[model samples]
Target: MKTEQLINALVADIGPRRSFLRSFVYATASGVAFDAVVFFAAIGPRPDIAAAAETWRFLFKFVVTLALAVPATTLAYRLAAPAMWRRCRFEVLMVPLCLLLAATAFELDLVPPSLWMVRLVGSNSVNCMTLIPVLALAPLTCFLILLRSGASCDPGLTGAVAGLAAGAIAATFYALNCFDDSPLFVITWYPIAMSTTAAGGYYGGRRFLTW
Candidate 1:
């Protein structure tokens, strides 16, 4: 079969059920990576995740970061799959749900758009705004890739795992874009970015999770 045909078929298989899962995973994983930009940036190169646990403020944000996932996921679930909400999986819900959190975080002034840009050298953040593009770009691409590849994971676990991976990718890109090279910058500004990604994930989840 032609690759294009294969992808179209895969999209069909993903159907409504898998579509929601894929979006959720991609968005959520991006959240963690975005959160880490500041986490590691504040600590600078070679941050000891264990040793860096002393500061109460940073720690609070860390907890809040994960904690925010729940409400964010819930919000996405409400918006996307309110009727058949139980059909939504955590991992699948992770992407858009976290994306929503990122959006909210940005609006709330939680994190930078991504890596800080000294002179706007091609950078971006994860948030509601980003979700718009994801809606346009990610699904079709992801669906096609999954289709051509002819690989599938359990929507529940696969989506969650994928989300964490995607979140990390987002974080890496974010750090690169903002690369301010300052402990203060990470500590002070990183959370905002994290929040933005979280919001995007959440909002996406809200709309996508509408099973």
Candidate 2:
């Protein structure tokens, strides 16, 4: 109850909080690094990545993916804490949603109607859907395991968010090798891939995170 005792107690509480956060960071980094190694070793970046980088559409992929990753990761981390979970602003997700929508519209307007379906389908639709989730597996596993240490009110939702974050992170790397840069392709297939991961997360969370 004394001032010194109260300060010491607060510091003690902060120590574990900081440690948990650090662990989350380390888990994420390690998961991503593992994914990167697998990606480069097996599927490496597109040979023409330098030329691809010159295009706005190609660069925008990173923008949209990173946008999604940042907010989803933050929400997942916040959800790990019982008190902070309620305060997390889900609206941050709108940034990536808006960006994808605007780009899709522009792509639709710029291309011919006949080409719309082609762009949406892309050459790698199947691969896009398959690989993103595959790449996300490591990160999603790491996130779900990390979440176990926290007290989340809605385990399924927290897991879903972690899956979304993992998917986004995977997509960012996948973009480097993806030849399809059209927003139409991105809008259509990327969600399917990421949603697959999110679905997995939901199931995992419900199965594991529950007290």
Best by lDDT, which number?
A: 2
Determine which window of 10 residues in candidate 1 has minimal summed lDDT: 119-128
Whole-model Cα lDDT of every candidate shown, in order: 0.39, 0.93
Please give, for residues 70-128, the per-residue lDDT of candidate 2 as tens digits: 89998999998887866799999889989999999999899999999999888998889
Which digits, one per residue and each the tens of the lDDT, describe model 1 over residues 9-119?
988865965666675556544444444554456433223435444544334433433443454443333333334445545554354345435544553464375643431
**What global local distance difference test value does model 2 have?**
0.93
Q: What is the lDDT of residue 123 in candidate 2?
A: 99
- Report the Cα RMSD per candidate: 13.5, 1.0
